[model samples]
Target: MAKKLEYKDLLAAGVHFGHLKRKWNPKMAPYIFMEKNGIHLIDINKTLVALDEAAKAMKGVVRSNKKVLFVATKKQAREIVEQVAKRTGMPYVTERWLGGMLTNFSTIRKSIKKLNSLEKLMKSESYENLTKRERLMMERKKEKMEKVLGGILEMNRLPGALFIVDIHREHIALAEAKRLGIPVFAMVDTDSDPTSVDYPIPANDDAYKSIELIVNYIGDVIEEAQQERKQEKEAQKLQAEENKKRAMDEGADLENAPESHDEEE
Candidate 1:
């Protein structure tokens, strides 16, 4: 069994540290423990509870076979989140968060389709026959699109949930998710409003250790759920095959059995 998150673990990761008291948002008072040296200390107990809640919710989302889009554009969180997202096989946005990423998904799909076609063209013989200048233009266009759309290249539909690093910095992403009625899970600091997200894990979003600890835990939960979903599909397939084989055997038995004749006086 995997190890559960402990209060000491969170403490070591600096998850209990929050922003300056003056910069704190009043809406996050419930999760604030107290002020020390002008910095608000997040309630470790509350943080643990919130983390558990968010993990459970995300597990359900992944188990349902729906994607969870990970968004972390901050310097401290981008690489950590990208690695976790890739390991979990989920779509992620470590680059700029386009305004209509979730709200106006149709346009994004068009861009993705174009990127696909461009890639195909580049691989075809016709691409080489083009002039040097034309080739350079196509390459630059492809590069620009890839930088923004690479993480979501395989995402063909809206995600079931969005996991964000900082709600304050990624407000646009949060807004787009809310506009589309998508659930959001995020690490909300003292400077941000926790109520803005569906599942808020209060922690020091700026710390590399803090972000890594929480994000890795969530990734593990998703991986476990994915494994369970795969097992369920395999089990269902096996049961179906067994039922079909049984029916076939029963039919064969009936066909080989001698037919009963009515007795005559």
Candidate 2:
């Protein structure tokens, strides 16, 4: 398991910082420790507790061999989320979240299929036979589609859960997940509604450092779970091989022991 998150680490990352006091959501009062100057200070203890719960939930989803789609379109969090998703081999939406991405999944899949066909066509010898203008148009389309959907190419089905940076900003993604009954895990800022998500980790969602620390921790949980799943599969395969070998050995022994069976006759 990865090292447990410490209060000092979260402090150093400015995870306790929240929106201005006036902008604070009443629903997040439990997570607000106090007001510092004009801003709300998030409760570090509650942050830790919420983070642990979210981590466990994400671990369970990944260990089941299901995808957890990462959504972070804001400038500060986009790259960080993309890197974590790539490293974990999970799907992500860093550029933009298309409407009906989860609710109308079949249509989105068709678009992905079209992108794939375009790629294959571009790689074939016949691609060169096309006029230059035609090739250019196709190339532009490919680039646009890749920018939007490249991160989710491997996601052939709906994700088991969602890990989002700012739930307020990614409300559309959250709504889609909810519509599909997919669990959502998100960083809920003081201005956001914690009750909207299934797993809400109350923290400073706007700070790059804060988002990075929390998102990285979640990524570690996913990676650890994936490793455990891999180990379990290997062990099961080895056990099955041993059982097959033992059964074959028993069959050989039985074949050789048949000579004494007629002695009673």
What lDDT would each prediction earn against the true structure? 0.94, 0.93
Give per-residue lDDT, candidate 1, residue 184. Answer: 99
TM-scores, all candidates, are 0.94, 0.95
lDDT of 2 at 99: 96
Which stretches in model 2 have alpha-carbon errors above 4 Å? 258-265
Per-residue lDDT tens digits for candidate 2, residues 1-265, read: 7678999999999999999999989999999999989999999999999988988888889889999999999999999999999999999999999999999889999999999999999999999999999999999999999999999999999999999899999999999898888999999999999999999999999999999999999989999999999998999999999999999999999988857555675
Which TM-score value belongs to model 1?
Answer: 0.94
For model 1, the run of ten residues with the poorest summed lDDT:
1-10
What would the per-residue lDDT of candidate 1 be over residues 86-122, giving only the tens digit for each residue? 9999999998998899888999999999999999999
lDDT of 2: 0.93
Candidate 1: the clashing residue pairs are: none
C-alpha positional error of residue 73 in candidate 1 after TM-score superposition, expressed in Å: 1.0
lDDT of 1: 0.94
Error of 2 at 3 (Å): 2.6
